[model samples]
Target: MSDLILLRHRQIPDLNQLDVYRQHGGFEAFQKAVTTMNPYAVTDEVKDSGLRGRGGAGFPTGLKWTFIDTENWPHYVVANADESEPGTFKDREIMEGNPFQFLEGVALAAYAIEAAEAYVYLRGEFWQIADQLDRQISELEAAGLLGDKLFDTDYSLRIYTHLGAGAYICGEETALLESMEGKLGQPRLRPPFPPSYGLYGKPTVVNNVETLTNVPLIITRGADWYNSIGTEKSTGPKIFSLSGRVNKPGNYELPLGTTFRELIFEHGGGIPDGRQVKAIMAAGASSSLIIANDEALDTPMDYESVPNVGAQLGSASIIVIDDSVSIDWVLRKTLHFFSHESCGKCTPCREGTFWMKHIIDRVHQGEAAWSDVELLNEVALQIKGKCLCALGEFAIEAVTSGIQRFEPDFRAKVSESSDEDELLVESEKA
Candidate 1:
């Protein structure tokens, strides 16, 4: 798998310095866009590149820019750095290791969109990264690379850094807009999708950290070169954040169609202690559990190929599960996380997640009846296709799949202990 955007900075020791980044062609894209090409041409180049949003939605980057409501004035570009998905930490590495490249990406996007002011909405936990980024922005400003006529052109861009109080809801494009505006960070209604009506009710381009990092390269190398790396419909290299049950669990930037075997066995040093691969939560806990099989192990990791095996290639977060892991216990942990994080904006998600947690916890501790397993599955199904956000909808992916694919594990947990058995007997008598 050939590296594209991710590996360009892999060898750079200190990405925090302005001089080091400039030495590696940091602001070349911004300079090219502002000096040689028109804003429309830059947008066209992105559209031609087939770049899609890396923040799980997979919306085409070019089309998103075209949707900007030109009738609205003073457009904005927001780099969403609030990456709080379970088992997802790819963005952190990008911001921490190659800070300037990411900032350059943000600047180029702002130039393409003609956004005079850009915002890097970071997660509260990432204040250190934000501080470093802020200093970089200031350095760029002093160098006349940013603010009030960038690179000696009329095209000027100023960037601001905003921090969130650690809410998963804020990761949503609309919710991030709300948080930026100092609101409660609840998701707004879509179809007025951010391009037309976004932050400050003006046209806004909100992209993830990794997604924006590719822009400078796309601008420098052209779209055709960008499309050549990955599989059809999902082009370019991806940073696979492999975790759990693996020897080498870290971010690996491989071409999109790289096999699961290579990622886990070759790159990740195989499963821990020679344990057999039982299942995989591709794209973190947000994806449905994929029962590990020969077909699955060889499946190409891409947007198009992953779905054939029953899951979306969301964020490329491959969480490995082994024989030592219990499917029931996995559900217990995920359900508890979702239940606590439920924003309470909608009743189905708020009530449904709490209900699922109580039932799964009881089952995990061997304090529930056999009938409870059936009831819990039903509750999970009810929550599906009926939520305000993907968080609520995907909370039950592991539980629902575990009950169907790994039934024996859940059933075994149904047998109660002496104390639970005595209570069950009393309830039966009553």
Candidate 2:
């Protein structure tokens, strides 16, 4: 409770209402920015705050804002609301419970980049949430917080909501831009990145819903205050989506450097029915399987620290795997998800995911030999660096990591004997 920043609205009843939010000091930061501060000043404040993107990559937020090409006309801001990652639902909660705050963050970012229009791109599954956000945007317009020339300034901004057809690939920024523009939702090559060339081929600032939601607070409280809360590199509070096998599973908001042990045992109420946690998936299906030993459990859950445990804190979607749950089964389910979600834009992701899925299915059915396990591992390796986007790379994380770290689980499912036994049989046949 002491370190809570993002989820403080949980304590405030009816905070979703415009008047209630205003009463609780809602758009005051945006107001301050629009009326008094210059655009670069706002961007500089965010830069000084040391806030990193909360959406998986942990990219520096302010640095990203600075990357927007100022010479370009009609700059745009897009909030990446496609929370399609399994076991990750923090963005939905933020939008549902604290819609206005998130919108204000969007507005502040729009102001920073001097963008006239901003869009919140949501997955089709979030239809209701999108509707709610649309109403909130209308309310802001009626209240003079959104639409044309806010707070008697020359600056004007408008926010819109667009729904995707549930393509998980659209979560990638360039792909998201492509989908928004009525094109196929496949990733565009980088370095003509979103900053220099984005949405409609103009400079755009595309940030996560959770990332934009932090901006108002950074502006209001000052950069030093935000910086003081989290670890040196990974600053500010993060809402870790806790799911699977935990007693009380939900979003637990804490500072960046909080340990996995505290998140699981304390906030999550530990494993249900006294089952031992065999492994911890730090970032949903995309995470490398982390062995749930005391050493790993004690490791702090931050962008800097989680990597020490052989996994990235990607999106911080912590899915606990108790001993009762076999890692092979987890891999099977994860592979199936990636296979189904593959955009088919490139060969590695398109064909690689399909091939890996069949291999995983065979292994899961106990119909594969020990060599098939090697083949599965090899296929994942082949797909590792040859993809068009992070989805392809993420597709192999659980497969390779599961086989390497939890070999016993995969080995148990194979019909054949050990490699030595198979070699002996081959020699006898010869």
Candidate 3:
């Protein structure tokens, strides 16, 4: 296996501490970027390294940095630590276990964007992680690694931690910025994206926690070395947060092109109780349910390849489903989460998710007929293209995919209900 970049703390003790991190060549990249390399040069290296966003969208990271409007004075950078996805937990581990590396990446990004100030917007439940990061930031400042005149250069930076009210919508970039500014956490319309107008109407570069953590390594070893690890298109090691029905459910850091079989079977120790794998939710609750066929199991878990199997490798939060679990039950749980977390800012998402939840509940309880199943599918399709943001669209992925791929599960529920109705009628006639 290739060397671990982001999760190096797993091998080294106390890697979270500034001193231990320094011993292992941490902050050397930050020092190099600030003291020697030009700001754009750092961005260029990241672009060359093919380090796309580890966040769901998988946009190119360095290109995002380049999008910062040079004309806009005093730009801002925000590290999105809001890991609200149902099956995603890799970011939390990175922040809690190997913090200095992540903070260094944030520093490098702030410098590249020429931003004097940055923010780490975390989910409310991560208060302990936030507290840890706060103390680490103070340590970096004290050691002259974060504050003004970093490495005696004109580039100065400061990072602050902001907490959300446990709203999943805040995971979206614009909504995160809004929440950071003390507004309702709802996504803003496009065309004036975050790069042009964000965080008090200034050009901002928002990145995922894992995405930022790769920056320090990319700078220290050069883009060529970083590019050599993963596939041509999807270069770099990815932290796959494997969960659900597996014998060993945890984060596994592997190269991007690794197959699903390798992750679920080899690294994850296969399914528990010797049960056969039924479905794979590659991107948490927001994912389209991938039927666990041989082709899909063999499919590469990368941004470009996962779509071939009808799902995105979103955050690589692979939730394995076994034969013991029905697809309808999964849909019910996912719908409930999306419905409850909907920001209610847009009509489509707010109303659509609410109704979807009710329909799925009925279907799951065997209290609805086949017509209800059709209506559930219809509602999901309607909400697909009409939402203001991706939340409404995400709310329907599993619903539509489950209904289409696992229609047998829904049919069985309806069939069971029909048999019950027939028995009741026969008893009444007697």
- Would you list the C-alpha lDDT of every candidate in the order shown? 0.86, 0.90, 0.92
Error of 1 at 153 (Å): 2.1
RMSD of 2: 3.0
Which 10 successive residues of model 3 have the least lDDT summed? 421-430
lDDT of 1 by residue, 317-344 (tens): 8999999989989998889888987778
The digit string of per-residue lDDT tens for model 3 on 166-214 reads 8999999999999999999988888699999999989999999999999
Worst 10-residue lDDT window for candidate 2 reads 421-430
lDDT, candidate 2, 313-344, per-residue tens: 98999999999988889988998999999998
Show the lowest summed lDDT stretch of 10 residues, model 1.
421-430
Clashes per model (N, Cα, C within 3 A): 0, 0, 0
Instruction: After superposing candidate 3 on the true structure, give the runs of residues whose Cα lies further than 4 Å from its correct spot.
Output: 415-430
For model 3, give the RMSD to the true fold. Answer: 3.2
Looking at model 1, how many pairs of residues clash?
0
- TM-score of each model, paired residue for residue: 0.95, 0.96, 0.96
> Which residue pairs show collisions in model 3?
none
